[model samples]
Target chain A: MNPILHELKAKQWIWNASNSQGKGHSKRLTTGYEALDSVLSGGFPSAGMIHINSYLGCGELRLILSILRQMPQHEVAQANNKLRVFIAPPFQLNAEFLLDEKIALEHLLVIKPATQEEALWSAEQCAKSGVCEAVFLWQNQLKHTQIRKLELAALHGQCHCFWFDNNRQCMSNLPLTLSLLLSRENEQMQIKVNKQKVGWAKPAINIKLPFKSRTQLRFKEARKAVNNIVQLRATP
Target chain B: MQFDTCSLWIYLHFTQLHLNVIENTQVHDERELAQPRAIYNMQSNQLVQLNESALQKGIKHGMGLASASLLYPQLNVHEYNEEIEKHALEHMANALYLLSSDIVLMPPNGLVLRAQNMLKLYGGLGPYWQNISRCLSQLGYRYQSAAGFSIQACKVMAKCKQGIISQERDVIEQQLFKCSLAHCDIDLKDFEKLKRIGISTVDELSRVPLSQLANRISRYSVGIIAELRGQAPSKVTFFAPSISYEDYIELLYDISLVDKLVPVLKHALKKLETFLYVRNTQCLHIDVSFYQREHEPLQIGFDSAMAIYRHQDWLEIASLKLEQVRFASPVYALKLVCEKYEVAHASVDDFFTHKSTHIETMSLTSRLASKLGQQKITRLNFIDDFRPEKSTLALADIKSKSLNHAQSVFADRPGFLLETPTLLQQKIQLIKGPERMICGWWDDGVVTRDYYIGQSQQGQQMWVFKTPEKDWYLHGYFI
Candidate 1:
C-alpha cells in the first residue's frame, strides 16, 4: 500500500472505526448525517469558534437547522441545562419551520440584537455563560479581536459557536477550530471543510435531493410551491 | 350549621421565633451558634422563648429570669420586644396568606390557616407543607407546624409541640388527650389546681364534668373542652387577601452604590412574593423608590407585558431597570410598591420548570422592549387586501397574535417584497404567469396587474407584474 494511504487508513480506523476506550476520536457533535460524520471524524469540533462561509441562498441556514434538530435528542442530553441561541439572523426565522424540522422550540432562543456590536456582545454572553450549548451568529463583518473574544468565550463556556459569514478573506485570517465553505452548484450543496482542528483535509461533501426530479420544483415554480407548502403546513 | 370535618387547619410554631427575626434584622448577620439562648419578657419577668439549645439544656418557658440566669450562668439572653415580635408575626401571616385566605392570627409566634381547600392546588399536603416550609425558610423563620380539622385543636397541638397532622376528629382528640398539662395552653391557676389533683394529662382533666371544672377554673374551661372535642364553633378572623403589595427595607448602612441595594431589595422581594402568593396574583406594575436624607424620592416604575409571579424573574427585570438608574444621593431606604396586580393563570409553570413558549417569548420580547424600546420588536401582520403594499408589520404586543387566516384571492406571493415597485428594464423569462388580480376599486384606489413569477437575464427570480397599459414592474425577489 502507498504510505499516504496507509496513514489515512490508520487515522480513519482510530477516529471512525474504533468504539473502544483507547486513545481514539475526541468527542465531536455529529452533524446528523452518517457520511458527513465519518468524513469529519465524528463531526464538528465541540468547542471554540467555527467559521462557516457560504454564498447567499446556499442552504447554510438549512444545514444549521438540521444540526440543531439533532441537539435535544443527542448533544443536549449530555449538557441538559444549556440553551441553543440564534442571534441576529438575516431574516425572520419562522418558528413554524423550526418546529416542523423537529427542533425543540422550548430549548431554542432567538435573540435579535439591533446592531453588529450588540450581536457580538449577546453571542459572547451566551457563549461565556455556559448556559448555551450552541450559539449561532450571523454577521457579515467582524474584527479579529471580536473573533478572538468569541473563541475564548466559546472555550470558557464549553460551547459550540458557529459564525456564518460570506467573507472568505477574513475566514482565512481567523484561527478557527473548524472552517467550512458552503456553495451551490447544479442543484446540490457542496460543503468543503477548508480547515480542521486535526487530521488531514478531505474532499468537499456533496448533498443532492433525490426528489427534485419528481417534483420539477426548481426556480420560480419552486418558490411559489414552497410558499404554498409553508402556508398549508403551518396554521396557528 | 354542620361541622366540616374536611377542613384542615395548619398551625405554624416558630421555634427560634424571635431570634430568627432579630438575626435577619441585623443585615448580613451569619452567626448561627448552637448555644442555649432565651428571650426574656420584661413585663412577665420570665423566659418566654428559647432556642433548641435551651430546650436541650432542660430550660423551660415561663421560668423566672433570675432562676434561668442562676441555673445557666453562661446562657445567652435576649430581651423580647413586644412590638418587634408582633410585627414579625404579622409579616409571617401576610406571607402565609398566599396558601389560603382563612389565616387566623395566633399572635406572638404562631399562625393558624385553613389549608384543606387548597391541598389539591399544590398537589397534596406533603408538597403544600414543603412549599410553606420553603416560604418560611426563605423569610428566615425557624418554624414547626401541626395540622387538624379545627383551629383550637391545631393551635393546642402546635403549642404542645406535637407537630402532628390529623384529619379525623377521633385521632385529634386522642392526640390532644395525650398532651401533658404543663404544655397545654390552659389557665395557669386551673393548670396548678389540676396538677394538685393529680390530673397530669388532658384525658384526666376531661374526666371531670363541666360543673366540676367550672368550680375549680373559669367557665372558659367548659368552652376549651368543647373545642377540644371538635364541638365548639369558635369565631375566627379569616385573613383578608390584600389587593396590592408594598414592602420597604431600611438599610443598616447608607448605600452609596446601586449594587449594594440588591440585598435589601431581595428582602423586600421575598415579602412581595409571599404577598402575591397569598393573593394568588401576579405583579403587573411595580415601582421601586429610593430614598435618601433630603433628596426627593427617585422612583423607578415598570409594567410587565404579562402578570409576573416568579421572584427571580421579577428581581432579574428589576435589576435590569436598576442598571439605568444613577443614585442622586446616598440611598438609605428602598420601597417596593406593586400597585397593579392581575390574578395569575392557574397553569403557570413552577419556578424551576421550563416556561411555556408563549411565556418565554413574552418575557424575552418584554425584556427587549424595555432594553431596545417597544417599537423595535415588530411582528409581521397580514392585512386583508390584494395589494402587497397594504400588508404591514406592527409592533408586537404582549399577547400572542395569531397570523391572519383570511385566504387571499391571489396566489404565489414572494417572502421579500420591494417597498415600491420599480419598472422592469431587463428581459425576463416567465416561468408561471397571468395570475391577474384586480382590486382596490373602492375609495379612490384602484389596481390592475397581471402578476407572474419571472426569471431575469441574470438568473434572479422575481415577482413581476404587468399593468393594463403594458408596462412591467418588478415587485419582489425570491431567494
Candidate 2:
C-alpha cells in the first residue's frame, strides 16, 4: 500500500518526530505550481499546522487556495470523509467565487464562531475529528498554549491545519511545521519561509496573481444569464 | 410417562418483598441501613413482612408490631402502602414486558412469562435470559429468576431459590424434587398432613395417588402437584403491557443537587430501551419532568434528528441537556416519558459508514447547540433575490435540505458578502466591467447599482458597487 494512504488509514502522522529529520526523505504535498514546488524542495509539509502571516488584503487566502487546487478531489474524498473547513473567516464566504475556483461546494464547510475562544475550539474539533482534509482557521491573538493545543490535535488527526493569524506577535513561538511570511512586493505575492521543521528552505517564491479582462467578465455574466434562462425554461 | 410440555417459562420473584412499592419511587437508604426493618400494616396492626435482619432478630411475618418492637427495640417500622407497592410492580412488569409480551402479573410481588417465544426471538435461551436479567438489574430491582418447561415448575423452583432453570423439563423436575414441602406455596394445614405422611419432596407428592392424596391433603395440594408435573394448566392472567414508555422515581430525600438525579434518570432510560425493544421501535423524542414540592414541574426534553433506541445515546444527550438545566426548587419526583416511537431503521454503522464528515459535523453541531443554545449554530443558503442580504437563508431553518453545489449562474459574485455595504476607503484597480443589477422594484427594498470587481493596492480583490449619484460602497471581499 502507498505509505501516505496507509498512514492516513491508521490516522497517524506519516512523519513522526524521529523520522522527520531528513528533509529530502520527508513526504510532501505538491503545491501544483512547479516553480513553487521546486523551490520548497517538493511541496508544503503534509501534516501539522502551517502558519501564514500576511498583511490585510494581501491575497493570503488566494495563495492557500492555489495549493488546495493542486490536490485531486477524489483523493480527498477517499482519504477520509472530511470536508474543507474554514472557521471564522475574515469575510462572508461567497459560494459563487469558490465554484468559480473549482472547489466542491458540498465538501466545503464554513463556521462563523462569534468569539476567539470558540474559534480555537472549532478549529481544534475540526482537526481532531480527522473529518476535514484542511482546516483554515482565521483567529487573531491566540496564545502559545492554544496554538500548541491545535498543533497536537492536527498531529493526532493527521489533518492539515492552516492558521491565518494577523497578529504577528502571537504567531511567534508556535509549533508550526512550516511558517511562511506573505507580503506583496512589486505587484507579486511573495511567500518567504521563516521556519521549516524539515531543516532546509529556499528564497521567496513571488507568485503573480492572474488579472481578469473586462470582456471576460461580461462574457461570464452573459453566459450565466443564458444558462439560467435555459434552466428556467427547461423546468416544468 | 412425563407430560411433554415443550415450552420455556420464566418466574421472576421480586425478593425484596416489603419495599417494592416505596423503593421503586424513592430510594430509602435509611431503611437499607436499618436492615431489621418491618413494614407494619396499619389496618392489621401487625408486621406484614420483616427484612432478614428483623427475621434474624426473632421477628416473624404477620406478628403483632408490639411483639416485633419488643424483640428489636430499634426496629424501623414503616406504614405499608399497598397502592404504592402495586404501582411499583406494574412499573417493573412494564419494563420487563419489553423482553416478552406474554407476561402474567403474579399479584403482591411476582411476574410469570412464556419464555419459549422470547428464546427463539432473542436467538437462544442464554441471551434471552441475560437480556431480562440485565434489564432488571439496570432498573434497580432485586429479584431471583427461574425458568422451566411449566410456569408452575418455574414458580416453585424460583420460590425455593433453585437458581436459573434450564428449558429442559428434566432439569426443572430435578429442581422441584430438591425443594422440601416447607418451601412450596401451599396451605399450611395441607402441607403439615403431607409432611406427616412422608411426602417431603415434590417428587414424593407426585407419586401419591390422587384419591389417596386428596383424602389426606386438600384438593389444592393435588392441583399444585399436577401443575408442577405439567399434568394441569395453571389458570394464569398474563399481564398486558402499557403502550407508552414511562417510569418514575420518588427520591427518599428531596434532592437539591442536579447530579443526584442522573442515576434515577439512567434507570428510567434503561427501561425505555426495553420499552423500545419489545415494540420493535426507536424513540425520536423523550421528555423528562421533575416534580417539586409547591412548585411547577420543571421539564426538559431531548430530541434526535434521527431515531435512536440505544440507552447510552439517550443518556449521553440527556446528560448534555441536564447540564444546562438549573434547578429552581429541590426535585422530589422524576419521570421519563416517551409516548411516541418510530420504526427502528438499520444499524447506526450504516448511517455513518461513508459519511464520517457528516457524522462529525452533526456531532459538532449538536455539541455547539447544546452549549451555545440551538439558535446559535447556522449555515447559509442562496435565494433568487439579487439583493445580497436577502439572497441567503439560515441553514438551521431548512435542516432536511441537502447542501447542493453553488449554481454557475452566481459565478461572478465575490467570496464574501457584507451584511451591509460600507464606504470604500482605498483606491482600487478595476479588473472587470460593471455588471449592472437593476431589479427589485417590486419588493419594499429596491436597489439599482453598478457592481465591479476591483483589486486593492495590497493585491486584495474586492467587490464594489456605485449608486446613481456617485457614492462607492465596498460590497464584499473575494477571500
Per-residue lDDT of B359-402 in model 1, one digit per residue for the tens?
A: 65456545655654455444444556657777544325534446
In candidate 1, the residue pairs with backbone N, CA or C atoms under 3 Å apart (3 or more residues apart, or in different chains) clash, namely: B97-B278, B98-B277, B98-B278
TM-score of chain B of 1: 0.54
Superposition error at B273 for model 1 (Å): 2.7
Could you tell me which 10 consecutive residues in candidate 1 chain A have the lowest summed lDDT?
A209-218
lDDT of each residue in B68-164, candidate 2, tens digit only: 7788898877777665556677877777776777888887777887887777689988888888888778767667788877777788778889857
* Model 2 clashing residue pairs (backbone): A82-A131, A92-B416, A94-B415, B25-B250, B26-B250, B103-B239
What tens-digit string does per-residue lDDT give for candidate 2 at A139-190? Answer: 7676767877898898777777898866655343455678888877545778
Name the candidate that leads on TM-score.
2
TM per candidate, chain B: 0.54, 0.65
Clash statistics: count for each candidate: 3, 6
Predictions in order: lDDT: 0.68, 0.72
Which RMSD values do the candidates have, in order?
12.4, 8.9
| DockQ-based class of model 2 | acceptable
